[model samples]
Target: MSELRTEQPHDDAGLRDWQHVHNVIIPTHVLSLAEVRERAGRNHLEVAYLDDVLVGCSTVRPPTGDTLTATVIARTLPAHRGQGFGTELYARGVARARDLGAETIETVVLSSNEDGLRFAKKRGFVEIERYLLPGDTIPWIDLRLS
Candidate 1:
């Protein structure tokens, strides 16, 4: 397997790459470039590649509030799943969250993505909630690391 390379998106092209992976993986909630830019300002957003091929993206929402909870989301293209891209991105997100003083780590997965749900569970994340966002049909599952 090619070594995964993750870059914090700073340029337009880099940002677009991140958006592509995110929109593709979560078709229910596609994000435009403007939205992605907005999110980048508030979160750590990154795009991942494997030997020059786009494979995934990640978001690390730094710990906030009295709970010091952070959200880490790793998204991999369907074609790239099971190749360790998600694993690498997830590890980096967790590390970054901890570095930012997270006392608890949480991840939210769209209920439709069985792979993501399974990945989070296997990593010791327990389901805390499963609910639908307003106007959305599919529910999202929120899991916290044990």
Candidate 2:
């Protein structure tokens, strides 16, 4: 196994890398190039590489409004899902959020994603709320950093 490395790619390159991982890991939820560009401008985007190949990606959005919480989202390619890549990406997000002075960290997972729920629970996050959106019921889970 190649050593895993995480990096914040430059704007244009990061968008392409992020979109590629998004499309591969969760095709149904893949973001448009425009959305990827927007996110790169608004969040901390990290791409994980195993040697020279992109294997995962993460986004940690800093708190906004009156909230002291940061939001994290990560995805690893299906071929790499159970190999700890997702966990690594998620941990990086949490660490980044803490470094940014966030008091809490949260992630929203679709109701049907058992693996995501399990991953959050394993990381000490607890389900706080479940909202039924247009096409999915998503659970909001959080972990306090303070």
Candidate 3:
């Protein structure tokens, strides 16, 4: 095991890798490459690797509106969980959010991802709300660090 290697998705390959992790982890909300490209234009997106293996990806949505709220979501592959990749990605995301002048931080998790929900709770995130998107059956939970 080695320290996780992460970089902003600047190339098409990097973008694809990021999108792969995201879509795999959040199967309920699969994103296409073009969708990822659009998100990259507004959000800070990064791909995480352990040596040459893809481990995860993270997103930091900078503070917006009057709340100064920023959103950080780290998605680790099922095979890569319990290896600290998510923790590293999350820490980097929080730091990036603060750097962008965020006053409040939050994260979202798919209801079915028990690991993700547990990860958020262990990090002092309290569930603020849970709601389903249009045409979705499973709900998404929104949590805020408290």
- Higher-lDDT candidate of 2 and 3: 3
User: What are the per-residue Cα lDDT tens digits for candidate 3 across 12-118?
Assistant: 99999999998888777888999999999999999998898999999999999898999999989999899888999999999999999999999999999999999
Candidate 3: stretches off by over 4 Å: none
Q: What's the TM for model 1?
A: 0.96
lDDT (Cα atoms) of all candidates against the true structure: 0.93, 0.77, 0.94
Error of 2 at 52 (Å): 1.9
Span of 10 residues, lowest total lDDT, candidate 2: 137-146
> In the order shown, what is each candidate's alpha-carbon RMSD?
1.0, 2.7, 0.9
- Scored against the true structure, residue 146 in model 3 reaches a CA lDDT of 94
Model number with the top lDDT = 3
Worst 10 residues of 1 by lDDT: 22-31
Tell me how candidate 2 scores on lDDT.
0.77
Give all TM-scores, in the order shown: 0.96, 0.83, 0.97
Instruction: Kindly report which residue stretches of model 1 are placed more than 4 angstroms away from their true locations once superposed.
Output: none
